[model samples]
Target: MEAMYAFFMDTAGMDEMAAHITVAVIMATIMFIVMALCAIIFTWMERKVAGFLQSRYGPMRTGRWHGWAQAVADMLKILGKEDIIPAEADKPYFIFAPLLVLLGSLLAWAAIPWAPGFVAADLDLGLFYIFAVTSLVVLGILMAGWASNNKWALYGAARGAAQMVSYEIPLLLATIPVVLYTGSLNTQDIVIAQQGGVLNWFVFRDPFLFIAFWMYFIASIAETNRGPFDMPETESELVAGYHTEYTGMRFAFFFLAEYANLFLVSMIAVMVFLGGWWSPIPGLDFAPAACFVVKGVLMVFLNMWVRWTLPRVRVDQLMHLCWKVMIPVTLVCVVGAGIWMMASGAVG
Candidate 1:
């Protein structure tokens, strides 16, 4: 951001404030477009992956090569559909809920460190900010369910609120090891600390950090409402869950936000545990941003694979896993990581 601001002010002869604002808008626009494109590509990849796992072709007719245009076609269809509202619904909250959900996901991208010095918001507490903003998703989900006045929607919302809030504890706890190691909440600092090679990545640095990685991964899956942990949208039980009454573009916003959040969490995994923008093989770190993105895509593929392969857990089981199992395990990881750091003289 500072680099961009300098470029605008120096090259375009703009005032400092004007340059700052322009750079901010540009970064935000770029983040939104990148997220949209990820949604499209990931939607296609997800179908193909599910097909491969299930021994069938998926969307082979929608595009010439491999149904590359299927997601685009769906977007076009959604664009042409009418926006419907329930007559009895609370109009304001109903209208605003999806937007709020999407905004929460989109805003987190601002803190993502795409490459060295390339973040939109390079705050000292980027990771904390990401967690804080993403909790807004629960609020939006609750509003969506309550405003729609549908029993299934309300039930799903309540489940979603409980599940997300429960999982957040372990998610933040798992990340604490990384923060302690790096001594900074800046995403870039975490990446920089893992620069030596694959083994230097936090996931491989110690047994406890390795454990922490999986803990973070599991908590993130639940946080994003992905399958096996997807209690909120269990079709058999909730009939489309919190968004049951939504239609057309409003529904599309929810869909887009789901995929966006999916990629966001996967990207965070890459950034925190897999060494963002750094090649695993030493001395081969060209195309840093592309390397970062490819790692993120692979993480997303892993997420889809897990989703396709696993059955949804019962609600009680989900809570048990989060509160009883993952929370305790992650607490152990945090303590163990601190002990390892001290014993190895990595910290005092």
Candidate 2:
């Protein structure tokens, strides 16, 4: 019968859809696992790097050659700790906050374009997608602090909301040069524009764009809650910041998301300004992508290096840097880049 054929085709299509969904889920799970592994490695490496800077051994007993397994040890301890919630806190929002914060971290990787034809969902609006996803993270932090029913948590939330929102302006403006040059908002298009080599990259295009690169990089650090900008969890002032009331895995989720966000922002820096996954010098066309990965990793290590060497800046100083210095500079860069693009007949 006609009805039987329709049902049979519907069932077959459903099965195919299920298979695609399963693959997407598995790929996402792998990305999550990879983020966790990177977190563990970075934490241990941070300690070791700090020790070397301070001239002391950081975690020698936890693993072979300077405590590599220290992260694993810390992982077990964090996992075993009792999960606690404040008696007066809003139970639903408090429970939802960390997961949502971490969700932003996971959502970012979907459009990163790790390799050619290897993105989760190569949306045409990749740059804007990351911006939108990350904007939600501040909301989650605000929720966590407000729901906790604690003054310090609220203060930290307020600070995070203000800082993130402020820095994003410069970050958004600085990326304009690269976007204008690429003529497309898609991440893949940006990468393809730099295909000729390092010289063809935006950073090498002119003096103004090079300045924009640093502008974007600094704002990105502040946006991701990294050091010098991590006023959110300032122990001396606000205790553990917004998540002060959290413990166990919930606490760990925030930590994981913080580090993963760190990685995401760094990769963003690479993609937008540093030619992303392309070799810094061009040539060897066959291996250009390897260059991009190396540059990105180097940037990640640079972030870790900066985090260990510098102390955290005050909130006022952070805001000053964002509003007074970074913003104006980014505005100039945008103008300069626009002028150059028009003169060169590069604009449509």
Candidate 3:
């Protein structure tokens, strides 16, 4: 943020406050564009990936080249569709729900450092701020479900709320090991701690941190409401889940937010566990932001791969994995990481 502020002030001849505001607006716009692009690209990739997994061609017609323009066409179609609100629905909450969900996902990007000195807000509590803001999606989900006044929407919302709330525990627990090793919650600091090479990445630093990474990855999929744990929007059961009554652009906001959160979680994994923006080979760093994006893209691919390969788990099974299996395993990881650090004299 300081780097951006200085650049703006020096080049644009702006006062401190003006430069600050300009930088904020630019960063926000960049984040929005990135999220929008992710939705477009990932949706297309999702189809192609599913097709490959299912042994068929996906989206080969829309743009005449394997449907490269399919997502764009879908976006345009959705943009022109009529905005419909259920006659019996609570109008105010229904209207506000998608915006709230989108806002939740967008707000977290401010604290994410794309590369050294390139963050929008380099706060000491970057990770904590991310966790805090992203939780707003739950409120948005509840609003969408209850506001729709549909039983399926309501049930989906209930399950989503339960699933997200339950999984957050292990998710946070899993990252605690990283926090312990880095001794800071600042996202950039965490990345800096693992800067040497692939071997120094937290996942390879200690056996326990490695376990925590997978736990974090699994919980992230659940937190994003991806398949195998997509209890909130089970199409076969909930008809479209919490957004069943949403239409047109209003529904698009929810879709946009989902992909935004998807990339956000993947980037978080990259930053926390995969050595954000740093090339795996030591002292050969170049194109830091590109490195970050490539690593994040790989994480996103892993997520999509898992989504298509696994069957959605039952609601009870989801809860069992979170509470019974993941929670205990992550707890062990936290303890083991701390002890390992002490034994190695990394900390007192």
Local distance difference test, each candidate:
0.92, 0.84, 0.93
Per-candidate TM-scores read 0.98, 0.91, 0.98
Query: Which candidate order results from sorting by TM-score in descending order?
Result: 1, 3, 2
TM-score of 1: 0.98
Per-residue lDDT tens digits for candidate 3, residues 237-322, read 89989989999999999999999999999999999999998999999788889999999999999999999999999998899899
Give the best candidate by TM-score. 1
Off by over 4 Å in 3: none
Give RMSD to native, each candidate. 0.9, 4.8, 1.1
Worst 10 residues of 3 by lDDT: 1-10
lDDT, model 1, position 281: 92
Clash number for model 1? Answer: 0
Cand. 3 Cα-lDDT: 0.93
Off by over 4 Å in 2: 1-16, 283-292
Which residue runs of candidate 1 sit more than 4 Å off their true CA positions? none
